[model samples]
Target: MKNAKSMSRHRVAIIAGLLLLPGFAFAQQSITVTSWGGAIAAAQQKAMQDPFTAKTGIKVIPEDYDGGLAEIQSQVKTGNVKWDVVNVEAFDALKGCDEGLFEKIGFSKLPPGDDGVPASKDFAKGLMSECGVPTDLYANVLAYDKAKFGANGPKTINDFFDLGKYPGKRALRKAPGVALEWALMADGVAPADLYKTLATPAGLDRAFKKLDTIKPQLVWWTAGAQPPQLLASGEVVMTSVYNGRIYDANVKDKRNFAIVWDGQVQIPEGWVVLKNGKKTAAALDFVRFATGTQPLAAQANIIPYAPPRTSALNNVTGATKSSLPNAGQSGRAVVSNAEFWSDNGDDINKRFSAWLAK
Candidate 1:
């Protein structure tokens, strides 16, 4: 009888262990997401995170960072990752995936669009990648204080470089990514040949040489928020700025600013999951919901960055349409070459830094 009792207790213990398995599998409660802060973060908070929490019962902890791979790399290398999901630019997504810093995203798992199109087909062409899902489209655009140039403001790509024509301090982002492309274009490199030209040594020098013309009069900006501020303070007459920021300055803050759509360098931004994050399942669910048609469109309503989803773009209408990167872009825009930047960013950034210091 004692032996029989012992066996029954052991069986009961085994049964209890089996009962807890499902709880363990479904226990995810919260996740952390990181992105570039400021208006973009506020827009995401309203459009994505708040709704996701209401739907999933999973709390999202938001964090901000200046754009780069350093923080993610340290978290991944140290195995103490705090961020489950991060918003990354296209080149960073490609480089991070290639370096195994981010989890491989399975597009098949994402829900179809509201229009019933598959996620794979619904996203814009050449944007789907192995480890990230494209969320929105933005551009580095030439924006100026309309009051500074009046109606005769800098019109063409050439005019941005023509100090003698529209002479004043011009603010350029201190990065080589768009600056080099703009330099080459200002020097008359055709849009179709931009990447090919930037690929060679002589072409690289040519871009830097062109930049040298405006170097004396150039005021460098490092943050997205700074350009609008610079223009407001009259520190610079014109600056290359993110489309959304300048748009907000005009429509929201009532600053008199205008975008010169010529030579806009448009690029896609996406959501990426950190490799080996503790909340991988929850992180991916958040990414799916955040990149969905409604969420992408919702963000565009708050800011002018275009949605990358075909279905989501349909939802964007009214005043936001006039602020988009594609507005008045004509045929003079360059879609950023993500692969070229992914491969060469580090080397070019180093050269750019050395030049900046001199």
Candidate 2:
């Protein structure tokens, strides 16, 4: 009777070990991913999160935030990081990585594209970083309500600054990044020489002087979702917006917003795994899956942001293509220089705040 009892106990222990294996234990794992919410969150849920859960049995808990590094900084400084993976702008990705606030991702671990090409070759050049991998290219472009603009609406990038021609209150994000670039371009700085000129005192003065022309008419917006709302309510005639938000407003909400792609500032956005998260393994797994070619392409169909992977772009189809920032006049679109921002952001942001106070 003692021998039989021992054998049964041994068998029960083996069964428990098997149950704890990855395949069976995956359902118990969950990771939190933070993003700029609304349409982007909804798109992520449909394209990546849901499918990832189904395939790996790992749950993704989504959270929303207005863009910034303060929350991440607080979490990391206190050793209480709650976000496992975060959707970061290119500048933050570089900045956070420099500050050692994020995990150093092993790009080699990412799988090959669905087309069988290696990930290194499949993704766009300069998009993959040591700590983050870009999922898509989003643009801050000019958008206007079609009904307000009528048939002969604001056409050129310069028109966004032409109060007499387009004539009404205009909206721009309160940040200096894209707004400064737009101001420089409107002041006749060439797209290729924008950052170069903006680095100079005279150039900074020129850009600000241009902005001053519209200062009284400028309505400042701080959130990604505000541009569309500002336009829809006739609060502003034209506003600089994330292309995805304008797309969602028009397609999903049946609003008549139109995007002016000329001089659009394209920025790479992607996932960064926070350092010291409890769910590091699950977070890395989800990043690999979500940034894959198919998932990126799947997201593009829902939101207008173009996938950073060539393979993913090839896979994207449907009406969303027309609204893609890269699909328009290529010469006019400016890919933001992340390095420049990483180096100069603090100084410029302080100056911008001073200008805002004035």
Candidate 3:
């Protein structure tokens, strides 16, 4: 009887050990990705999470935050990091790299080429070093209500200021992300000379003075969706809005909104891995999968935002064409200088906010 009891105890211990094995393995492999909370997040869910789990058997959980880097910094400071991978703006990516918040990625791990995207050092191997990869390219373009403008709507940034001709309410982004660039362009400064002129006090003042001309007529918008809605409701005849949001509103509401890509402010979204996470390897794999051509193409199909991968562009179907910025143009247009924004964004934002408030 004693021998039988001992044998029974040993079998129970074996069963318990087996039960705990899978849990341990699961604990070893889980990645939390952080990104902006909106359509982009939905696109990521459809394109990345479902496919990656099916292929790699790795579970992906997404965490949404308004300002991803700020949240990451808070996490790091408190020593309770929750995110493994983060979707960051290029400027924030640079800032994160400077503060040692990213890891070096291994280029060899990245999948081979994209034909649809322009060739760039923008996507290279290694963590924190080449810390971010361009995921999507969007623009802040002039969107006008076709009914309001009729056949004589604004066609460029210069036209956006001609209240006498294309008269109606106007809207612009509250952020200085592209306001300075647009201001300079409206002031007849060449795109190439925009940054050069903006570096000086006189040039910045000139830009502000140009903005002052339209201040009362301006309807400042803080949300991406606001401009399109304002335009559709006839609150504003023309507004500078994100290309994707405008496209979405146009499709869903059948509003006669058209985007003017000329002199548009291009903004590229970038993906970066977080520095303080337990699942670094898994997070890197997620980044590789998320930015890879296949997944990116899937996202472009559902949204107006274009992937930075050259090959992904070819996958964009006719159904998605209406949302693309410069759809009327033959090829891709120039991308904005993210590095310049990184260096000057804060100062410009502060000044613009103060000016607007005053």
- Judging by lDDT against the true structure, name the best candidate: 2
lDDT of 1 by residue, 1-358 (tens): 9999999999999977865875443344788989888778888999999999888878889999878899999999999999999999999999999999999976797888899999888888898789988988899889889887799998877788999888899998879988999999999899899999999999999999999999999998878899999999999888999888987788779999988888899988899999978899899989999999999999988988888888998998858877777656654898898899999999999999999999
**Clashes within 3 Å, all models in order:** 0, 0, 14
For every model shown, what is its TM-score relative to the native structure? 0.91, 0.94, 0.83
Candidate 1 deviant stretches above 4 angstroms: 1-28
lDDT of 1: 0.89
* Candidate 3, position 325, lDDT: 55
Q: Mind sharing the TM-score for model 1?
A: 0.91
Clashing pairs in 2: none
Residue 30 lDDT in model 1? 83
